[model samples]
Target: MSIVQRFSKIFFYLALFPAVIVLCAWQGWAWWSWATAPPAPKSSTGETSDADKTVQIRIPPGSTSKQIGSYLESAGLIRSSNAWDLWVRWLNTQNKGVFKAGTYELSPTQSLKEIAEQISQGSVVQISFTIPEGRNLKQMAAYFESQGFFPAQDFLAATKQIPRDKFPWLPSGLPHLEGFLYPDTYQIASGGITPKAVIDIMLKRFEQVALPMYQKNPQQIKLNLLQWVTLASIVEKEAVIPAERPRIAGVFTQRLQKGMKLEADPTVEYGLNIQQTVDQPLTFKQVKTPSPYNTYLNRGLPPTPIASPGKASLQATLNPEKTDYLFFVARYDGTHVFSRTLAEHQAAVAAIRKQRVQQNQGAIPQPN
Candidate 1:
């Protein structure tokens, strides 16, 4: 070993040692900083508006950790995919929770660990929507479309293919799920927001809330399930005021008992796919139009329920207000004028028409 050769080798070894230490230190610092730093940093005003805003990210089933990390990085939820990989490796060593597939509401302000924990625990976001009472299938379909849930016709088609296997109590040969879909606010995981899923959930809710009402049959209304729902649907459309629901149901019941025509305008509108606006009402020709749903022409309940009635309307139909009144007319103020005879009904109709004419400069109203 010559002195020059040995010294040169020692120097080379010393230089390499410092370089390795500096490189290791730089890598460690980078790992720590990335683990702690948020994707969206705070502004000079100390407000993290962008960081606070949540983004919806869906993790498909069977995605690997690498794929998930890349997804998070692309979504701007994580500072770096490499840092996420390191964190995942550490988590794997600890045998922590497994990542589950779902729709997540993630924010940029969340740390890598926080986001990872949320996804691992399957903390999925749930989306909710409300179906107001008196909305028929077509209206409901349009509503679903407006909310970007599904196409309108898609929902309409789903309604036709009734899920009878799961719900055996549904009346056989139902043309469509018009009256049975109980209306209410429903919350479901975002990943499961499909047409069939919505319909099944709504049907299940109907089974839970309304089916029992008929099963108990406290009032023992002679009407079958289909008949009860049909009558309640009529009451729902005609009676705007909550208090008038029972009275309206009573009128329908009396007319049914006497075998007279129901003469409900809503039925004609439903059949014709038209709405009776304040300026334009059902015409004489429209009323005389032959349709199965035209209660003005048909002598019984409509073929199917015109709309989905609420629990209150269903209860009102079952235990209607016992009255001798056989007819009623809407005053356009969420109130009705009840009549027991043809003359009284005609007079009340005349009074409403006269009031409309006075309000609108002698404009005549369409005949009932």
Candidate 2:
């Protein structure tokens, strides 16, 4: 209790004050961590229900770690992009969260670790339905029905009710959703895939496939989305040879620029709605059909696409071969003879008719 002893004791308490404060702060932090830390992710049997929260998130090809993390975050499958990035860096996962790009079935309840592993594996299971090129919406619908998938009527209804507001690139006053359903193989990623979702998927794929071209040079293609797809559908229906797509695209492009009637036979056939095709010559009356879809009667491109053009046809329409040839007549052998002059086109048509006559004769040979 002497002055020297009291002063020494005060100095000792002051020295210990900072340590006491540090210990108290550490203890508080530990209590908060224990109180607020996320519970351990419950194990799932990997079975997905038809919950609205669960969705198929597509990790675009070649997406960086940050890009993928952002997508998952937006989809509500991850907490946040920054958290995902930090976690991925900590795990040093396969490619460090630069996951394999594909459509993945994801749920909010899944642990970040489980999601990362599934994506790194890159397994897109389920069925893939291939929509072939040059098939009209009705034909496409029929194919869907034939496969015992969605009913044809339901498929058609979805096409009729495309959420165009969701797709800004899709122009207004489209003839119908005929040509926009991009022709490709799409996997049914989930058990709850509905008809409307299927339509959205096709258009989304089209956007993924074609939006970059338009975005790169919006003015390069002189037509809007509807017009471009319309012309491409015609070219898709006309071009039989794989190599002839560009040439066909060129023919349509030049004709559109010159203000000439397309004179495309497919347009006339579509106008007539004649389903039974028996490899016979069209009657002269069929050429003069009075329908909006008939390019022969109408002066410009059809109001809507006649069929779904494949990616090649769409690309060809956007970037044509840029030729002077204005006309083409289909030969019997899935090829066409190109011509710039009317007389040349007529001669090509005549040659095809003669070839067909010879083929018919050969089929019915005279017994000698």
Candidate 3:
């Protein structure tokens, strides 16, 4: 009964140890699991859209899973704190710095699974706003203000407050955010969507999108990053057709290299400070109105970006197409006609004017 019985008993307990631990874990999860049943159909109010029914809850910085769960329970989003705790441990979203700390939009109507996934991913409630290419910072400020996202004055002020040291991608010596806003559709959390927050996120997004190309070959970018963005901003306004960006970029590059005037129409328009903006066109005299921003009068890129340049325009400036073309004329159909020589450019200009004249003329009908 000694050796054989003892060894058999030891093996039985050892095998049972794992199973017991597994059982304990299962029980612990069950204890923490949300006990609430599915939400009823009519829980939302008539005034609130289904999307608007979510209650805003903030997870304070450095909050533990247990603490987060307690907060959720207090907010009445979950059945109990322990239930939320259990769900967090099960999902492993709160594991080893994976926990996301931010204000979250959650509803009691949502399943524990959905809440866990949402918070783990740090998905916050966001209001979307799009920045169109070639829009200057001032224009952007007014647009955001009109949308009630933030005050235009506050937005402009926040641009100067951004910590340049934190972001290597952003060029220093710029007076304002200007070209770096990186025109794109952005979503921000409803309540905390500050102008500073928008600028921060967009700067990061710009870094993410543009840095790769620069990192590949910094020398390929002929101009400094800030200057390149400035030039790209001008190109953004010039090229309406997406296919023409690289070529338009090429024409600008050629002009720059030859020490010839850029003579870009947008630069002059920007310089004139047109109150109505692009809605109003500049007269011929405004093009000759000398200003630092006016490429027709200036030797190089503007002191800063004239407007926000999109990715296509940015890339175009970074790697301008190799071409001899130095001039371009806008056509009536929102396209450009590129010309390599002065004579050729003059011909294109005359053709464009004739087309516009034809477009403006009213056809005469013979009397019946």
Candidate 4:
């Protein structure tokens, strides 16, 4: 080769080498920024509103990394889908993990790496729901429906079809999952959450929280699971004051031991599916009306639990306060007056009614 041609070739090689190095440096900087930087906020007024704060993006099952990236980009949760694809490829090479399928609550302020990691780790959006104590299965359904969780009928239907296969500890021949569902706050995954899933969670909670107490048999109560829950449900409905649970439970226990009718007002209401307001208390006619759940007319516990009892009521039923109290009457206040005999109970009831009448006539309230 000629000297001129060789010199030209050397210069070309040197120039090409520098250009390649600069290109590589630029690419590295771009990738670094893309990985670490969050998407720019789209608020024109320079303030993040509630809508712009967070977005819910669903990653469908069997979605490829590219598809997830595209979704994130469209939702304004990420800067670029191309960058996401490249980052995901790199993650695959490192065997970090696969992105799971679920609804994700993501914010635009989160970096690409943070969002990707969360998805990969299956950190799905969770919705917290609470079941207050003493709520019946029907009431629970209504509440769930009102909260947009599902249809009231769906929840009710799911309760009827108990998944005994998943929960072997569930009592056999359980007509419906009434008292079995634990009453407490629950964190449920946002997407694809069915009524069955919610029921399973609640039953699992019951198994975890309340079942252990029964297994321990601390009180050595002779009642089976059904009966224990039945009595607890009654206690839950009857007790207004938290401190009165044990005493109320004691009254029922004495009634049961003596083979006397419970005649609990709550049982009568449950059977009739009616709540007695202060202005309209349980009438004699209502109490006299016979139903399977009416403790007033029935001899023993109702066929099933009237409502879902909380931990306190369950505990109170298991370990009742030792007392001779066979009867009790509500004073319209949260407190109830306990009596050793029917005469005392009747007197207490009369006194409360008289006091209530006086209060209605603008008279001073008397102490129970």
Candidate 5:
């Protein structure tokens, strides 16, 4: 009797235990679903999701989460400002405040989680600008304005204030920073860098690249920083062909040594009215005109450089091509013909003039 009673009691307890386990599992599943479920359709604020359009938002420096949320809502990046704020705050609490300040690009289709991640990662707007070599401060300022980097007046004024002493390679007391702004494409924020800051960065880069080259040359050939820069500037303006730069430099150096007139066309062009084009053929009158910058009339280098030079021109000036050539004239083709003797130079000039006359005569319309 005792064995049967014990067996029945044990069987009853085992069945009861299974029922209790199933009930607990069901309750736990319900709790899990409630806790891990997606957010409600409408947040605490009365707002609906409009996930159809994309928008860009600028979260400026020192902006709070609430301010950023309002900006996002105003930009149409999200439908609910309050919902975005709450989500961002939740992230701040969870991730220990890792969000960064920037102008963020967001789409309405993005979930709060995705937008939050992008903002925290400092995703922002960017722009590209190109500063071409040999551009004067005025020209560079115009370029900055055209690219929306800064206002023209602001840049111009800032450029005027840049201390010439900061760049010893530039002639002292010049009107503005010249021959120091290195030219290259730069990625910058829209309206982010100050004009002075931009100029300073470029000049720094120029010094970094050019200083070593200046240091290595012999003292006679190695001019002081300013003279080297001047020579480089002349070399830059003299030849459009990369291969011709060293040869052009050689001719200038020869003239400098012999106390001869440089007679460089670029210097003549610089002396002419601003309307003159670099590519236009020079008239004999233009060459003979007396100006402070006219290398033909003057025996030494010009008062100042005509343009900013690039690395290649700088290098060519430092290490010129060794040749006996003292005169060079542009040939019928794009290249130049060099000569060592005055007679040879005269003959070359005559040949070039004859070719031009023949070409012009051939192009003239004959009477019917």
Candidate 6:
């Protein structure tokens, strides 16, 4: 038609073309979203088999999220690194890069989302080990080594490196850390556990449990923290029955109060480097051994604790049983009879010997 009419028509077409393109683009985006959005993951069920991509990923200390994600993918615990990264970012966990260094047991049944959540939340596998009361440091070190916590030599070396000043409770110039490592079951990660870390945790536990007792009755007992621990250690090793601990502690306390030699067999054994039960009765020569730890000569608690003490022994030290008994001997059964006089102690020992003789006769004799 006319020029003005043609120009108006062209402008209208141009504008309409842009609107059509905009509408198409919007529709395309909607279609793409529908196609690409992931399906809601199925809730894990009992039917899931253990064989489904089960892997243990060890995220060592100081590892970054990128490193952790790559490790999971390599271990086949997750399907895609991108998915895991996005899932971790969305969770906004405080454990951002602080994934506790550990050997985590992971399963293939777990989605990338679940795996990421677990890692970020420190859902790592835990290993537990218990140190029984009365165990010496060497025994404790052996137990740790057996549990794969650390090398036994490493534990021993770490004890040497421990600063005496830091632990004022410890006696000076001690050859090794013997009775100080408190005995208790501990939960720790199976990976990245250093010797120092293990020792530090045990020492802290010791302080938490034993320090208060020392503070409460320091002077009344007339023993320093280390001396108290030393006495408690002897009590731990000597008393087989739980009920007898207080009585044994009382005997020691009485001897200490009277300035009499402790003459403890365990102390003599410790001096002689003999930890097991002696086949023969202790002789005067055994008691006369020249060691700083020999209670027979020292006339008090040894330089340090003979072994680590448990709560019962510690309590016995704090509250000794009031008894006139000064000597005790183990009966053939798992018990001990106490006596006050030397004559009474001799009679009890004779009775125990007689019982042992009868027990031997009662048993079936092996072909000799």
In angstroms, give how far residue 144 of model 3 lies from its true place: 1.1
lDDT tens per residue, model 6, 1-368:
99999999999999899999999999976754433232223346745444554566678778877788788777766656666566566555544444567788877656655565666667778777788999887777888889777789888888877556666766677777777788998877666477777777788888888777677753435676777888899999899999999999999888889888887888888878775442376677877879988987887788777789998998899788887788888775668888898899999989888877777788858788
Instruction: Give the Cα error of residue 38 in candidate 1, in Å.
Output: 3.4
TM-score of each: 0.84, 0.64, 0.67, 0.79, 0.69, 0.74
* Angstrom error at residue 242, model 2: 1.8
Candidate 4 per-residue C-alpha lDDT over 18-64 given as tens digits, one digit per residue, 9 for 90 to 100: 99999999999987796557876456787776536888898878998
Kindly list the per-residue Cα lDDT of model 1 for residues 90-156, writing each as its tens digit: 8988976589887899988888888999998888999899999999999999999999888999999
Which is superior by lDDT, 2 or 6?
Answer: 2
lDDT of 2 at 247: 90
Regions of model 6 farther than 4 Å from truth: 1-55, 59-75, 80-100, 113-123, 164-175, 217-220, 278-288, 364-368
lDDT of 4 at 95: 77
The per-residue C-alpha lDDT of model 5 at residue 27 equals: 91
Model 2 alpha-carbon miss at residue 179, Å: 1.0
Tens-digit per-residue lDDT, 256-291, candidate 2: 889999989898888887742437756778888689
Instruction: Give RMSD (Å) of candidate 5 vs. truth.
Output: 10.6
lDDT of candidate 5 over 270-362, digit per residue (tens) = 667443442467887888888987888888777666667888988899888888899998876668889999999999989998888888899
- Pairs with backbone N, CA or C atoms under 3 Å apart (clashes), candidate 1: none
TM-score of 2: 0.64
Q: What's the CA error at residue 329 for candidate 1, in Å?
A: 0.9
Cα lDDT for residue 143, candidate 5: 79
lDDT of 2 at 177: 81
Q: Which regions in candidate 2 have their CA more than 4 angstroms from the true location?
A: 1-125, 217-221, 275-278
Of 1 and 5, the candidate ranking higher by TM-score: 1
Q: Cα deviation in Å at residue 243, candidate 6?
A: 1.6
Candidate 4 TM-score to native: 0.79
Worst ten-residue run, lDDT, model 2?
Answer: 34-43
